[model samples]
Target: MTQPLQIGLVVFPEMTQLDATGPLQVFAGIPFFAPDPGAEVHLLWKDLEPVSTDAIMTITPTKTFAQSPPLDVICVPGGPGVDALLGDSEVIDFVRSQGSGARWVTSVCTGALVLGAAGLLDGYRAATHWAAMGMLDAFGAVPTDERVVIDGNRVTGGGVTAGVDFALTLVAELVDRATAEAIQLRIEYNPAPPFAAGSPATAPAEVVEDYRERTAAYQARRIAAVARAAAARPTP
Candidate 1:
């Protein structure tokens, strides 16, 4: 019998809920496409306690760092909380260890920052939230501005909702395009944004400026965090 494909979706305090849950909904549906798919997703954290998200939601981890089995996939989700994780040795260590053995290492939004901090993204062309694209340079990662990017075993997604696309892409690679298509249809993945303001290229000049101004401080902090994390990485 094929061993179950173990997937670990990391959770941390103040992480954006959608970054984690969106991909989760897709991976959880694996059995629907292939009976006995042998896929299991685990919510991983430092402990088993519930952690608060950036929004009002709270999520509880299904496995602690110490107890998690060898996983086939390691997924890190991002939000403002990643600022602190950039310098968190415990979190970085867990990611580094798991990624060494996992078949795939991935991130959503700024979660790529966490993977970079862990030293897994060095020389990899990765994707991240546009606002933080420039920050990837601090960790030796070439940032690509796309909804999803796959370089070797490293897969990354852009901001928030892009997790779904990332998950579907992963599914297609793992199973088959037909299975992925079936899953997409089941989930009704068609998208029709009400406005064209979804990306900076299409947004009004004033809107872009306002967002830059609003996020300036946070972006600065994130840059500093990435630098610190990079400097502290053990010499390879």
Candidate 2:
């Protein structure tokens, strides 16, 4: 029997649920898409317990970080929790250790900031939420505005909803483009938004200013968190 490819998705309090679930639904379809598939995905946290999202939703992790076996892929999802995680030693250590050996290290939205916090993104071109893209430079990453950015084994998605795009891209890399397309069709992944304001460039100026003001506090915290993490990194 072919051993399965173990994939771990990190979960923490205040995370954006879609960031975790969107990619999960895509990867979960691998068995149906690939011939003789070999992949298993799990939600990982500090412990096997319920974690809250940015919204009212809460999800239970399938495995604890300490108990997880070596993963072939490790993904981190972002949200308000990212500010806290950027300064969390335990979570950063877990990400650092897993990423060192995983076949792929990925993130959705500001989750790239978490990877950056772990010192995994140095010299890498990564994607993250447009609102926070500028913050990547603090962690030594060159930020890209694309919906999905891939540099070697590191893949990162733009904002919350881009998780789907990130996952499909990863599927193509792991198996074949055909299988990935099949999965995309299976999920009816075509997106047609009613509004054309998904990004800062497309959104109305007033709306962009409002969002930036609303996120100012979180951005401030994130700035401090990234500084702390970067300062703590060991000297080469």
lDDT of all predictions: 0.91, 0.91
lDDT score of model 1? Answer: 0.91
- For each candidate, give its TM-score against the true structure: 0.97, 0.97
Instruction: Score candidate 2 by TM-score against the native.
Output: 0.97
Give the runs in model 1 whose Cα sits over 4 Å from its true position: none
lDDT minimum window of 10 residues, candidate 2: 227-236
Summarize candidate 2's per-residue lDDT along 1-236 as a digit string, tens digits. 56777889999999999999999999998887674666888899998779999889899999999989999999999999887887788998999999999999999999998898888899999999998899899888999999999999999999999999999999999888998899999999999999989999999999999999998897888888878877875442
lDDT of 1 by residue, 8-124 (tens): 999999999999999999998887676556588899999999999989999999999998999899999999999999888899999999999999999999999999988899999
